[model samples]
Target: MASRRIDVRAVSKDPTGQVLRALYAYASPDAGAPCTIEHDGRSIAAREGEPIALSLLGAGVDTLSRSVKFHRPRGPMCLRGNCEGCLVRVDGEPNRMACAAPARDGREVRSQNSFPSAQLDVLRVTDWFFPKQFDHHHLMVRYGTTINEVMQSFARKMAGLGTLPERPAEAPLPEEIDCDALVVGLGPVGLSVALALAGEGLSVCAVEEEPFAGGLVRDSLQWHSRDGERLCGAEASDRDLAKLRAAGVSVRLSASACATFDDGTIVIQSDRALWVRAKARVFTNGCHESVGAFGDNDLPGVYTARAAARALRYGVRVGESVLVCGDEDPALDALSDALSAVGAKVHRLTEGERLLEATGSSSVSGALVGRDERSAHKIKCDAIVASTSRTPAFELAGQAGVEAAQDLDRQCFASWADELGRTQRSDVFVAGSVAHGGRSPVRESAVARSVRDYVTKGRVR
Candidate 1:
């Protein structure tokens, strides 16, 4: 496959130009510094405060890193940085998720889990020698006595880079947190739910994973209300955070909701562990970015597109030149502009059949972009921010044995419940993105109405 360079004829102005400007403004130097990444022959840079992966993608590097087992090509699957697919070596440390890492200039990156190159990996030969041995059925047939030792030795040899580094654990004192209605996530939908709940004088407890609030709003390319007013969730996020505080709603940033139990009891873990026994819980954890299955998808520089957007929000540069590959849509388009604003040469794979593999050594150097759906073309890049789709954050709900159904209209899985958000379990209720099919708006009013009805009617609908 011959590589293709950006054709001057294909150059076009970004459709999401206005929104990109706003995003860059929000992440300007006054807000913070810029982050940078080096790939191929260029250096991509974005403002500080944005996620490293987002900045890299914005600059147009779609293939951040490669996969491990098959040395198959890979990209960002989840945006919250939980999936190990987007791991990159930062400052010599292995397995740093580009999505979670705040971009900073001078940070060194190296791809992991491959030798010679991520795309042309020599270890892929192992796949040919023991193809059947890696399968689940083969592993299960053997008893532990004979196979355990053999497996352990093989595992030791096959174990690649990016092992989790050991760190000391810190424990904090327990505290009682109270709320009339508790909402998880700080995205637009979550904020809208909080606004509605707070307006009703219901004590709301909202938690966000970022150092700041805004959920997906921070990276929203641009969303227009029915009234036609442009709403960038960044400002709205700040206002929403302020309003929650003013309404006496407790807002916890950098906090994680570890679990939800029966009888409205929730466990939250942050720098400290705490318990919240609220009357009702509004689950708005939203969704994670979807990862791609390919050879060496675990290499450094391979990251999700959302991670690159985070780098832009934080005002950090991800790389010099980035390749943005994904289904053509406003979300992906916005990333191109964001990366360009921060100083990355952006490239987009608009044509659907252009499947390609990200290639590099130590770290990603470029990609083999398929041209016109036929043969492969090459794009010189340092990082690749590739994405497939988003998946709902239903871990807690799934574990609780909540009945989930696929909502084809929304391209996601949803659960059935009454108008007031009651489930089969009398005491359990769901709202926001988790209840709906992971839509952005997620019918904010619906969430509030359900919570309000439950609080007032005092019965499962």
Candidate 2:
């Protein structure tokens, strides 16, 4: 039977989509020799020398395993290899992250603590039987004599969670890099800053936390040039991506902005920790989307506009119907565009009341959005996409004492900035949405250039 071709354009705005497409192309046996490792009863079609899970997700398998206690379905959450939400058993190993796990093609992936496949897991029966009882495993106490025996006799005992296989340990190594300017974030603004710096022949480094560059651009169809030209459609964006890479700027993909310091030092972690000493730094870290503060808002199928954009760009169709509501323009506009691009029937409310309730018990069936008075209406959808504006990724900036306030207009926290985009800290410069200077191609370039000139000329003195 012919396999269904998921719309790859859905996730085209996300940089990860490119990595996923590259991985799939490299790993498919039909294309060439599989690029993965093969072992006893375990084989992963490896590409890019990483685990199979990232590729699988890029190929559209977000729900790797179900929750242990509630038996609710779960997928990749913290892609940082930290959150155990995506845990699945590979070969003889138990409870490993699919995002961090490499796909070896022939490798056997099994559901832990559940019968049959992770998708159709029978252990979900526990949710029906023990409804409110959130117990995945029980606790236990060892037997003893005398006073210990007396306590043991009175107290009941249970066992803890099962163990995982031992892994080989090794000492870590240190690495370093030096650049004239380091732009953290590979979004449109980040790439723009890097390109601008490279145009001036400055040694610049652009770092993106995701496995691929381009940041959110891969999922978005709208691309703007400095002259205010709307570069929509997938092909133009891909061409732009190639141009960014062709520039002399060093693009660090799959790297994170781990931390920042007072002396213009930046720490990024990928396979290992990299200490970067740059003459100056620009943070285009962007904003966070808001989730509805209602019952079961964190359930599967519930996602932010950015996440929806990712899902579509990466061939991960949310569902047949989509519900989109938000406070701002870009997010709502983006979500609407992505959903329409992927053939999803969309019902949108730009500035409606708050989300009252998410209808379905499992997997979404519908949602309730308060209208006015008793006229609250129900928006039926398989997926809910929302944006409550965005907050500056200010953890690092907050450490530098960049002042922030709740903006009455956007109804979100924004940073206080001067005319030249320099923060209160004389050494630090802020750019992109991180500075809350409003989002636009022109504004971003102006802010980035101000900082670039400040760094290149030392004019702040």
Candidate 3:
């Protein structure tokens, strides 16, 4: 069977007359190999290193999974693997995150927790029947023991996620490693700190959960300005990575920090388990994009601004017509402009106008926008790109004995840190959005200096 390819425009000059490329620009053509993966018994062609979720979305396969209780259809909301919307089954492994998994030939992919199929799930009737809530714990409290037993059986069948593996799972042996410094995230701030520490003669290990080290820069459309010249984000990231390698920093991509111990031990998981003991640890895990609460916002066609950018970066077409809503931000502006440049009909709701409801059956067909109750208006669009404030990813910080407090101004939980990135715990440090709220080049530099001082002089200056 021939594979179906998504229609994507080639990289060309942007409206500014400058050449624009997707995530990374290849200098020379080297089409290494093509592979095919089976999705719901249909073969889909995929690139060597492209993510599996991108391949499915590009082929017009949305509504990857359904919610547990309500059976509400879910798709890729955050391409960063921060949400459970993209969970699917791969090669007998249930609930594997599709966005994080790479495409491989001959792999069997299936939608989990959905009866019949994800698109036409029979379990959806439960949503309509319940309407308000389904408290299974006290569902039949007044009934007799016989009725309670029957209800318990039905509830047990309905609850839980994914199918268990038929065969017993084998666990990989854990490997222990020791280093002078361990950086939890490989974003710009984390990279800066890792490079600075490694340059100071410390054995540094930098771990990134993504396939690459660019972080959010990989999905950005704008370029970074240095000395009044524009430099693309991918190019800048590559240059920085080269410098880190030269400074003898061990960079591990696709590795996740699963747990952090009080003794400064970090448990990392990739293909295998790894235990790293470091004298000093720095967290730059960044933040997760929050989705706005609105009617039917959990629909398959609704996506956060960051998720939209990521989809576009991987040549996944969001929609021919897009409706964007939310406050002003550089990322949102860039996404709108890019969509327009690609011939997508872009519609932006005015400031203070909120998304009232999204109307669709299987996927988003249109949306309702209004500033208030009296100003409601309907717009026809296949995709809705919504924006919301970012919440700092401070789970690892909290495990390390760092005190995090809510910042009302930023609307996110921020780790207590000085200007120099020193957290309440002397051994643990925080940088980037984890320490403060948002990204700033000046704050990155200050945090880097503080990390360097702490690593060299045993204290943050």
Strongest candidate by TM-score: 3
**All candidates in order of lDDT, best leading:** 3, 1, 2
How do the residues 50-102 of candidate 2 rate in per-residue lDDT, one tens digit apiece? Answer: 45454444443445667655566665543434345567766657666665565
Which is the leading candidate under lDDT? 3
TM per candidate? 0.70, 0.69, 0.92
Q: Candidate 2, 305: how far from true, in Å?
A: 2.1
Compared with the true structure, what per-residue lDDT tens digits does model 1 show for residues 1-461? Answer: 12211222223454555544555446544555545665332476654655566565555454555555555444444557576555777666667777676667766655567655443457667666675656634563467656867776766665776545445445677667877777777776677778888876678788777667776666665653423556565665666677768877788877777777754444544447657777777766777765365444455566677766655554444566788877555777777775675557887775554546767744577877665435777788776777775667767666556777686766777654555556665434566566654443345666676677776676544
- Backbone collision tally, model 2: 30
lDDT of 3 by residue, 1-461 (tens): 11223234453425662224543352112332567888877787776666678678767777889999989999888888888788999889898888888888787889888888887899999888999998877889789999999988988887899889756667788777788788988887788888877766778888888877777675676786644766666666777778889899988888899889965454555567778888788898888886788898889888888788777666565777899777677877888877776557889988688889988887889998998768998899988999887788888889898988877678778776777777788888888888754444236556656666776788867
lDDT of 2 at 275: 77
Which scores better on TM-score, 1 or 3? 3
Clash totals for all candidate models: 74, 30, 0
- C-alpha displacement of 398 in model 2, angstroms? 2.5
Output the better candidate (1/3) by lDDT: 3
Consecutive 10-residue window with the lowest summed lDDT within model 2: 154-163
Model 3 lDDT-worst window of ten: 23-32
